[model samples]
Target: MTIITRFAPSPNGSLHLGHALSAIVAHDRAKADGGRFLLRIEDIDGGRSRPELAAEFRADLAWLGLEWEEVRAQSTRIAHYDAAAEELKAQGLLYPCDCTRAQILAADPVIGPEGPIYPGTCREKHIDPHNCDGPVAWRLDVAQANRKTGPLIWEDELAGPQTARPEMLGDVVLLRKDPDTPASYHLAATLDDAADGINMVTRGMDLFSATHVHRLLQALLGLPVPRWHHHSLLLDEQGRKLAKRRHSPSLADRRLAGEDGRALAAALRAGQLPTGISCSK
Candidate 1:
């Protein structure tokens, strides 16, 4: 199969250095293999997503001399996500979850790879597909879903072969209360990869655990599987992962300051740390 990869970024904030690393890696990998690279705007978060930032993201990639064969936005594909969610719900593999972050934190559940594992407070609550009282998020029944899919495995280019362990993350929220974007990152991304014919997924190592759950989703939804390459994440001077919440230095800022975006991309490709930036282990 022809190698295909994508650099998906949320337009909630400016494109930071960490974002550049991921984009450059994915872009170059596709070019090196003479394959297709796609740019996807993960702007499904209704409140956080800034549509204007999507244009800035495109400019940033162009400044870095990276080009993509196609571009798409998650906000444009709500029906596909709803269709997938409906399929899982029909099979009784999903339940309406009204749990809030504060409530889950207060419950003091086991700290898993992705922070506090959801306590499954609303696991038993069933919502009528035709009539729903109020807004509620959709959570996957991992245990039930797993029983049907049986043992599962997916290969990561960097981490090698791995068994599916979706249970570690607990019942993940696949859909949210946002009517405009009912799909969560887990559900949308898994489906998008298959829909885009992405045979290989290149992303940060931080999302490694997510692949396990995604594998299960693919199996349950009958989506095509893709190999993964979870690369190291860019870290700050404090050894913490670079995050948009922290206002990490953005590519736009650097570009405005007359920095050479191509040079920076080359340095990242060569594994050379730029100034205080470090690769997370």
Candidate 2:
């Protein structure tokens, strides 16, 4: 099978060095294997997603001397996600949740790989959608879902084999209560990868734990499994991950300053990061 990889980024902010490294890694890996590289705009967060940034992302990739076989925008695929949610709901793999962040925290939730794991406060409530005054989130019933699938495993290029442990995430939201953002990241990403025929999932190691839930979702949905390459994350001098919210320097800024994007891309390939930026080993 032809190796297929993608660099999926949310268009909520400018593309920073960390984002560039991820895109470059995925792009180079595909080219090295004579495979297809794709670009995906993860703009599902309707409230936070900036549609204009999608175009900027395209320009950034092109400026870096990278090419993609195709591009997919999550905004155009809401119906597909809705269909998947309906299927899971029908199989009793999902339940409605109305708990807010504060409420979950008040319950003394334990911290898992992704942060505070949902305590399943509303899991057994069987919330009636019609009776509810507002939208309700739909969370996966991971324990029950696991019972159906039994033991499962997935491979990471760096970490080798991993046992599927969806419970660590503890009833993750598949569909958010927010009307503007219907599907959660876990649900949309899994479906999108399968839909796009992505066989090699390339992303930062920060999401390595989330792969457990993705593996479970694939099993439940009967989607093809793909090998993952969880590459090192780019960090600042303080060892914190570079983030847009932190005002990390952006690729667009450098490009506008007359910096050569191709040269920067080449340097990144050689593990030569910009000042104060280092890759997490």
Candidate 3:
């Protein structure tokens, strides 16, 4: 089968050094493997997702010399995500979670296969998570999903190997539960990957647990399981991760100050080089 990868970044903030690394890694991974790469705008939260921001992200990626088979914007496909969430709900593999964040914290559940795992606090509430009018967070049926999903173990081409126990991956929130949008990261991500025919996923090691949750979602949704590679993150000189919120030296700022895309790409590569990437640092 042909390999396909995605470089999906939320447009909540500017794409910085970390994003450059991920985009280069993802784009080059597919190109090197004789595969296809896709650029996806993971702007699920319309409340935070902005057209200008998405435009900037695309421009930044292009500036860095990253390319894709096709570019997709998540906000444009809410209807499809809505349909998939309905299907999952009908499968009884998803449930409505009425418990508030504070309530869940009061419960202080164990950290499951996924980080900050949330057990089904309202599992018995039987409340309809989707009111169809407003927004609320929705969660997947983890315990029920476990029955269908087995030991979740996979090898990371970059980060070695890893596993996420079903018991460890507690029920994950599917929608923001009456969220302003239809699906959450976990839901939209899975649906988008399957619909786009992505067969391989390359991203930062920070999302390793998320890949596990995505694995469970794939099982529950019956989507194809793709090979995953979690590459190391690019760190700032302070040893902290480069992020959009830093505001100190945003990629946009650097670029505006004459740090062209090539220069920015070189700077990121100089920090943490990905294997097989022939860049002028």
Q: Best-fitting candidate, measured by lDDT? A: 2
Model 3 regions more than 4 Å off? 111-115, 128-136, 159-166, 237-239, 270-281
Superposed Cα deviation of residue 232, candidate 3 (Å): 0.6
- Kindly list the per-residue Cα lDDT of model 2 for residues 1-281, writing each as its tens digit: 78899999998899998898899889988889899999899988878999899889988999999999666689999999999999999999999888889999999999998999998898789899879878789999999999999999999988899999989989999999888998999999999999999999999999998999999999999999999999999999999999999999999999989999999999998999888889898
State the lDDT of candidate 1 residue by residue for 43-97, as single tens digits. 8887888989988998999999999966668888889999999999899898987
Using TM-score as the measure, the top candidate is 2
Question: Which portions of model 2 miss their true places by more than 4 Å?
Answer: none
| Per-prediction tally of clashes | 0, 0, 14
TM-score of each: 0.96, 0.98, 0.85
* Ranked candidates (TM-score, high to low): 2, 1, 3
For model 3, what is the error of residue 27's alpha carbon versus the real structure, in angstroms, after optimal superposition? 1.3
Global fold similarity of model 3 (TM-score): 0.85
Model 2, CA-based lDDT: 0.92
Q: Judged by TM-score relative to the true structure, which candidate is superior, 1 or 3?
A: 1
> Measured by TM-score, how close is model 1 to the native structure?
0.96
C-alpha lDDT of residue 276 in model 2: 87
Q: Which window of ten consecutive residues has the lowest lDDT sum in model 3? A: 272-281
Against the true structure, candidate 3 has what lDDT?
Answer: 0.72
lDDT of 1 at 271: 89
